[model samples]
Target: MYTLLIVDDESIAVRGMKQGIVWSDLAITEILEAYNVKQAKQLFANHQIDIMICDIEMPGQNGIELLEWTRTHYPDTVSLFLTAHADFTYVQKALQLGSFDYILKPVKHEQLKDITGQAVLQWKKNEEKKTFSVLHKQYVQQWEEQLPHLIERFWQELLGERVLPKSKQIAAKLQQLNIPLTLDDQVLPILISIEMWKEEFNARDEEIMEYALRKTASELMLASWPGTVIQDRNGINLLLIYVKPTDPIIRDEVQKICEEYIRYCNQYFKCSLSCYIGESTKITEIPGMYSDLLVMERNNVSASNKVILANEQLQVRPFFDSSATSFPVMDWIMLFELGRKEELLEQMTESCTYMEQKSGFCKEDLESMHTSILFLLFSVFHKKGLSVYEAFPSKQLIDSTINIRTLEQFRTWMYKVISQGIGHFMLHAKEESEIVIKTKKYISEHIHQEFSREDIASYVFLNPSYLSRLFKKETGISLTDYILKERMNEAKRLLVQTEMKISQIAESLGYMNLSHFITMFKKVNGATPMNFRKKIQ
Candidate 1:
């Protein structure tokens, strides 16, 4: 609803206009009447007036002056000038002040209604545009702010909550802006595999390696052509060059560049380096292409060490699929535990090989697959008393900015680590599985004896907290709750079949404090123990 202010110095004009016009029918619900400009100004400040119908020549302040005031302050408020005199200058001045439409004195009812309706439509359109612009900007800003945190959480889950020192990763990510890729744009994703020969190195050394890599990559690309590149720590360098390629024969120009650097660095230091070039992708598809590159790189570990290789045909299209089928990776792990080793290995090897083959996959696609696989892997690993960090042991590789191109690479890299990890952790899982079953047996045999989580933990040789989490994950209920349910069920049975008293039943279930046992029984069953017995009887 909009408020329309009527301003006129003449008393008769104001009365006739107010009474004669049906403001409500015109879609102007609220009306404020002012005899002069001063009261109109006060009304304008206090309320949101959509349209001002004011007399041109007033006693104190004219309509022209009022329009000027509105123009300066309340610009959104539409102004319609009313003039008695047929002065050309006054008409021109009203238009110059941006009056919606001016009406001469003794205005026709038809003209007034038509103009008001037009002004209302214009006002609504402007408001809608304003709303849409605000919403769009807000949505973009929220994603911009939240994207990094979400990415970090994803990597954390992928690596199984392994805390890697993040300064290098943070610096690399900060350097890489989210550049949009178009089909026409020539963006190159270079996956550089970096390794340290020396075991002892501090944060300073890591920073130096990052700086050397970025500087070297930048200098080489800039010297070759006029281009700008942002190097992320992931060891994946993205170069966006506008230069037209001079050599038509240069089949692997990007690979050549990476190989030259790798060879140069290897000669200078004991540290080995390898670089892989993913297929050239349009800007919009870079993220998905980057992921495929990572997968491809992981698979490359199985191949003989090459400083750099250009896999021009390493496309990311194969990895882009629905996540619905991906969730079975956990179910695969459980199947592995059930001695379906052949099926488990086949699935793991196949999936890893696929990722290894497509290291040039875009970051968006890579992260999606990465999240799906990591969650599945973690579900089983966490259940079996191992964290993701311990299972993968490739935080450096997984967290790197370098694009993985192929499933073969991921297969080669992950298979060994995961298989060895299984060997190390499987025995512990068996032990825990044994303890869990034993604990259940102990509880059933000695339900009349006092038991605490600490006692169970001690018997199982596991941490109390870890055991609690494991019990909940495995059984979908807490240890204490399961025990209580069992005891309560036994008490109910005894009450109906053996004619046991409520106090005796409580004692039989290992509760020395009869009142406490009765309270627990009431809480679980929503009735007193005696009442439960009576009802059952």
Candidate 2:
């Protein structure tokens, strides 16, 4: 509903318009008439006029002057100029005065209806934009308020392997959450391993003290640089300092912080702990690096309030591997989970060959190797959420760890254990493979449609973000990267096998912009579509 004001020198002309046009059909509920600019100003002051249809030429004052005044005083009200003469000056000045439209004397009622209909649509759009602006501001404020919790949640997911930990994925998520870090950037991690509390405290009280220690570490250790103090699921507090990969002297400063941090914790918190600093590594490699630091911590059973630097010495060691990094426990766990059985066996055989060449390898060393292989089996089963009975149906398999008296026995035991473990993994992996196979099938069917992760997630009955994590965990590649690969593969096939134009192919593949399609094609295929076609021909 809107109000209208019609101003003209001729009362007959105004009356004629009032009678000719159906104001009710134009969404105008009330219409007012004014003979001159003064009367129009009075009407504008007293009434809520949404639109004004005014004649240009008047006896005392004209529509141009009235529109100029309306532009300053009531800017929301729109105007249209009406005149008998088609003078260039009238049209130019009418436009300069910000009138919605300039019309010659005789106008069709249907044309007027169309123009006013467009005007109402534009008005509604403008109102919607204003409302959107307010809503956008409100959302920004809420996101800022929740940013801390969001960052904490991101770290927890990343540590738990519930989020894809690739550079592009991490950077996009960080950008979406407005975090000030990139995954390509390197971070130096200091593992704060609390050995034992000197004073007795309940689990809840200890958790509170640990929280206080994390805050203290943030205030003291990270005061000089930008960093975060994160506590993992196991209640392991780690202070991650964001640094460049080429920044080699961070360890020097790390020593200073750890010395003070250790002293402060011992004196106030009444706990014995050690800070083991790792080399600067990319964000995607944080979990593996943190695991290595855990191995270093677990090996040092005698140290207390110490500042230990973990170099490549502990790189491939597992929690109970001691100093025997002969086999990469985590890497092998990753391989077994991905169902790479032959490669895993070959690697195990290679590790045994290397051990055979060494004269100092003894039963203790064999015990470390045994622990490493057992860790891989346990870790993979845990990740799949399977029971011990389901993983190893025979108690003999668990008890057989003690039968390994010599290198040959250890080798035999490992082969039997790994082969049995993989059998279970492959059976459960079929369930995961079903999901991956279903996802790939869905992507193949909708390659030409623009759909979101949420759309695919809903199809698979999973959460949107969780779908990406699951895909990456199972396939060793991000879901988005897999989709891009499929799209590019289809593009190559079309370019070589079909007679379609590049633009048509791009559009068929749901790429609206031809240049963007070319750029992406070049990025993926190392050649543009035209060049690819040329080579094919």
Candidate 3:
């Protein structure tokens, strides 16, 4: 329901408008009448007037003056002017006073009703916008309260590769999140690896202790510095320290802080920790440095509760040299090819134990061993007339092999890949035989239709690349070449057996363009389609 006010000096005009016009259809429940601006002001002060229809030439205070007052006091109230005169000056004055609309006197009832209806809609829209503004402010306040947690989540995504490492993108995000450091700043990465807890703890207790550890690290290690501490996906705590360019003593200060943190953890928390401090680099290089620290932590085989700098780890040769007797690569490959699963796994375990005992393996040795093992597997699979890609379709064999960083990761990846390969080889061998049979049947059935490797693979429910590899492995020819061979064979048969024209035969083989078909036939048969048909006939 809405209240409407009519201000005019003429009583008859106000009466006719109130009684003659059907106010109920416009949702105006109550109509308030006023003879002058003073009476209109009193009515407006008493009631919540949604719309005001005032005569422009009222006595004493005019409609323009009333509209001006309402514009300041009741800004949400929509106002319109009704005048008996078509004076351009009055319309100009009314419009300048912020009147919603102006209507000349001797008004039509329909036109007046239409203008009032629009005014009512405008009022409702204004109210709705006000409500939305309030809610929007409330929501923005809530987001501001959670800004810190959101910033931490963004950092976690940055380290986890969910966010790309572009400097401009990272800098813009930092500014938007109001982070104190910039990409141009030098940052040191500190990786804290928790070895063991002296006492037993439940999951909830462990979470609380981890939070306490982060707070302690920030308080002690970064008390005089600016830094951020985040727990990564591996549950390892890392601190990114920001330092001034002229601060030459910052490293020594940070080292002493880390030592104190280690001592405090062992004493109060009953947990042993090994700290891996990375070299200071720019913000964009932090991800690489973080990866290096992860590798160092995984490769640590020394005593716990110590600080290990990345440079020191790089200088020392902890694992055996590659020239030493590592693992029997050929023997392992032979066992794998022979399908001796138990013996193969045992041999792998024994080799890993021996490498751990020797304990001086470097990055190059790990990569070399990875390459050797992959080469051995590829050879065994090749000898068995199977492609590794066809045997294991889901695994990215090349990329995963290249990304092997530590000896432990290499060992785990090798064991998993070999084990999965052995299982898939047996299954895929039979599957590929069935696929080849089905593929041949499909090709022969659809020989007259335009189809591709994707269509054939879709029919057999296999990936196109995988199916192509399987077809080539079994048929000694690529899928495209084989399709062309089948099409040419059919063309020859049609030319020799049927009395169809060369164009008709080409169209029957799904070649919409006759020239393309002739070109292909010439390339394959060393003659045009008509030439081949005439020679055969």
Best by lDDT: 3
Regions of model 1 farther than 4 Å from truth: 1-6, 10-49, 60-77, 82-118, 126-435, 497-501
lDDT of 2 by residue, 407-513 (tens): 78877877877888888888875465555777888999999987755567657644343355567677777676677788889999998889999999999988889
**lDDT score, residue 267, model 1?**
63
- For residue 28, give model 3's deviation from the true position in Å: 3.1
Clashes of each: 73, 0, 7
Compared with the true structure, the alpha-carbon lDDT of candidate 1 equals 0.62
TM-score of 3: 0.48
**TM-score for all predictions?**
0.41, 0.57, 0.48
Q: Which scores greater on lDDT, model 1 or model 2?
A: 2
Error of 3 at 405 (Å): 25
Per-residue lDDT tens digits of candidate 3, residues 143-259? 899886777777777776622677888898888888877776778889887665555343446668878888899888888788878886545688878755776336777788899
Better of 1 and 3 by lDDT: 3
Query: In model 3, what are the clashing residue pairs, if there are any?
Result: 318-359, 318-360, 319-359, 319-360, 319-361, 320-360, 320-361
